[model samples]
Target: MSRKTFIKGTLILTLAGVLTKIFGFGCRIFLSRSIGAAGMGLYQLIMPVTAVCYAIGIAGPEVCVSRFCAAYAASRDHLRARHTAVFCFGMSMILCIICTVLSYMGADIIAGYIFHNPHVAPLIRISVFSVPFACIHCLVCAYYISKERTVIPAVSQIFEQAVRLGAIYIIVHIAHNKGEEITAAVGVAGLVCGEIAAALLCAAIVLTGRRKNIRTTRHPGIEVKQIIKTSIPVSLNRLALHGMQSLEAALIPLMLTVYGYSAQHSVAIFGILTGMAMPVILFPSTLTGSVAQMLLPSVAKEQSSSDKLIKSSRMALVFSLAFGFICIIGYTTAGAVIMAYVFDEPKLSGYIRIMAWLCPFIFINTTYKSMLHALGQAGRVLLNSMLSELITIICIVFLIPRMGIYAYLLGLLASQAANSALSICAFTRTVSRITTHKPLRS
Candidate 1:
């Protein structure tokens, strides 16, 4: 893995990510228009549960597979990589089942208590079906990524988005022609269908293209205890981060309702903030995400050489900062126009501007977290994420009641900033320790 190869891999993955983001955002716009603001609100409202479940089922194991498989491949242990993939897939399936059951049973409580909308329970349950499919797709994609084969995942992403968008269009049109309430539920159905398609497509790609020479190790002499120990922290970190994010989704809307906003207004604001504004603000982050995913394994495989790790980490950080700044400026200048043109709502311009401030912090935080995960510092990531979320939640609790939607955005910005600062400090220290010794000879 020379720097040239690394750059080449990064470029392919980045291009893929950009394509995925474009398709995804396009889907968002179409869905928002199809469902209207209230429908979009209902659709967006249940997603926190979706995000948390998917993260719990997939995130840590996928990351672990990516990092470990890359290292194993680098060491010429293809058999180990295969075994690890098997173990990961198996584990993900089990988690998916558990999540499915829990989500179904707890949907009522989540809707009534968490979101303050008993009507949202059915939507949450329906959306939960996507969890296993998403988890499996992520796990398979991780293996391909570990092999530095970006094309498959890239193609799968496009396919997934196409399927999702197409389904949403047809379903929403039919449902809207009937009534708004049905349209909202139909939108959730579209999500479930899209996830199913994505999972099947990814599975087909992996099965069809996986090399025959890569043999699975029979009873690989690895300790399950060690694997679990290594994986738990990463899992818990993802769980905390995503859990908090989900909680925020539920809380923000509830707070808005308490502040005298109508249900429709609360939903509309949430949709605009999460679906419209956040996407625009975070568009520049796709580059860092692609690079970080690639860099994680690259860093782990080169862990013996601190210089290499630090060099890669610094390069990624610099790129993220530069990209984030560009996004901030671009969104600041053109965000309103884009919102007006896309959503036919110029009133959203303020929210868009405020949300754009989150770009730099979010990008930096993501890059830093990736670096820590690469270095097997999942506990640190967890602690930092929990602290940031706690701070943000406390702020939101105090501010949202008094200040309204703006307070929610402020809390988000503050949390991301805190996370970014902590990640930078931790990543700096780790890189310093790694680079203190001379680079190992290739």
Candidate 2:
């Protein structure tokens, strides 16, 4: 794609992201208010598991499809692009189905042994239902994104958020009308419904819009091998990262209890940090994410240039740094006010303020990882991520008892800074050596 087309696609994604974020914030505010911190904690507790499952089932394949399809589509080999999608989609469907069955069957072990809460069992079962839907939706969205038709994906995102909110409103209040308090299962039901709607929407677009002239037969064996080859490394990289994150989620609340706090209080505190403050801090990251989305496929093209890669990297860097510092100033200036005004959690200003230092590095880290992944440096991405998460996990294990939540706050800053620095250094070296020769896209 030309630079103009890339910018157009990024802008479309950014606009859609902004709207989705707004609707998401609305859902958060209302959900928190209706269900209270305990309920929010319940939902937050399940997020790490959700992330892990989604990473294994969808994130890797979706990214592989996006990057490889764009590579194929750029050469005008539309048949190969279709084949990539089919192979990845089939892979995702099988994995997600297996995940769903295991999650449902082992919910008791996960809730009892892993999370130390029995109520979480039902919520896990409910949330697992969304995995298949989300996996299929991701593959479909990847195909459209590879074609640079951002409008369809954008519409699907908005539609999903709207459906989630509407479903939450109805599901939560129906239980209320029956004199029952809102449950985490109900919250997850909303997510499942939304995913199903989104899956259907994207499937309609991809299946109905195919041109008749495109080839009808593709070598499933060859394409499947190619897709898995690209996807497995990315999958393992993300799986390791998310697996550590899930471990961190379980550890955070447990370790906080050593600070002489009740488990309920610790869970509530975790909810505030993960569910409330972190989202606010990461709000502007939507732009970086949009650029990353566009960057992957653009960089995956065989004809992609060294100059173009460097230009995009530098642009993402400047924007991330400028925006990061700008956000730091905003959070430092009125974090308390914003928290109070937005999520009604005024006390979390300290967490937000402390985490402000992570903005630039975190944002820049996202762009670098995307560029590196498309550049076929999955091992480097995995190493940087593992190192970062390792640092955070180590700190949580050793220091949360002595320093309490402040330990986590400092650990996050240190980890993001470490990850970002490593990625930038790797990218810089890769760029310098490849200045006179094209880096391998695959």
Candidate 3:
């Protein structure tokens, strides 16, 4: 976790991320053209279930495994680190299994009752199968990240995206040949295939790789307890955040309807914003996201050194600010052109420009949250996130009906700004206390 190693890992991850995003954009553009906005809306509607599943089964364990495994490996306790991964994997698998069962069983109710769109039931059924595989993919990646082995995870990412793009293309091509109408389920099927591919690759590497020397007969009872203890708060935080996001997703179209648009039109608009404009706006986050990925484990490993933590935090903050503003300028200049011509969605141009302001705050918030997680401030993170989502939710509920989509954009800006301010204030206070040799408070 030296500075040089951190930089190298960041570069590797950033490269991998760029490739992945490129592949992903290919799939996205294909889907948009093939299925159109309404179809993409159906696909986006079910994302809440996917996100909730991940929050339940992957997010918390992934963080705990990365943080604790890196900590153990720093102490040269490879056995403990291995045990942490195994235990977390087991817990995550159980949760994922439950999630899959519930989702599959209740797909009809979930789509018809919750989302008010029964057309998404098939997509939900197809999407649920990917959760367990995604859990496996995330935990394995977390383990590799803890050991500072970015190559395997980076490779897995590219492999997954390639498989996804290929699978989607093949499925759509076959359907077209058969004169069948394209649906969101085709996209969901591709997602499932990609997760399965990545999971199998990661599992194979871990099984065949040389960790034999670290094998032990000792039970991991204490480690399991520690993992659970650390994971619960993080898990709840993720679950809450995803839950709010799900609520927002479900409510957006409904709120838009209240704003005088037809149901179909509202859903189509939702699709354009989420699937088209937001992607272009958030594309540059690949770099910040990679840095955050590497920063969390590095910060965890160096938490004992206040100076190093502060330095790392500063570096991440500065980079995010500079990179985010650069992206703002780039998007302001080219975003409209990209959206209008590339996606063939002329309507998205204004939305992209408006959403471009989200870049700096979004990137900075990501880095600060990673630092907070390394500081074991999960509760504070949860509080800030809840407040952030609450603002968006309020706007969606109250303002969207009166002001239309512009209200939602305003909410996004306001909420993210609030969350960023809160996270920076808390992160600064926590780090400054460490510099003062005082106990850190959540």
The CA lDDT of each predicted structure is 0.80, 0.84, 0.89
Q: Assess candidate 3 and give its lDDT.
A: 0.89
Per-residue CA lDDT of candidate 3, range 202-310, in tens?
Answer: 9999888856555657864436666777788788889999899988989999999999999999999999998888877777888898899998899887777888887
Ranking by lDDT: 3, 2, 1
Between candidates 1 and 2, name the one with more favorable lDDT.
Answer: 2
Better of 2 and 3 by TM-score: 3
Question: Highest lDDT: which candidate?
Answer: 3
Clash statistics: count for each candidate: 1, 0, 0
RMSD of 1: 3.0
C-alpha lDDT (0 to 100) for residue 100 of candidate 1: 90
Model 2: per-residue Cα lDDT over 1-442, one tens digit each: 7889889998998998998888788888888887767778889888878788887898778988888889778778877777778878888889989888988899999989888888888999899899999987788888889889888888999999889989999987788899987766767888899999999998887667865455556553336666677788788888999899988988898999988789888888888888788888788888889889888888787324678778878898898999999989998888647775677776677888888888999899989999888887777888899999999999999999999999999899999999999999888767765775755433
Superposition TM-score, candidate 1 onto the true structure: 0.94
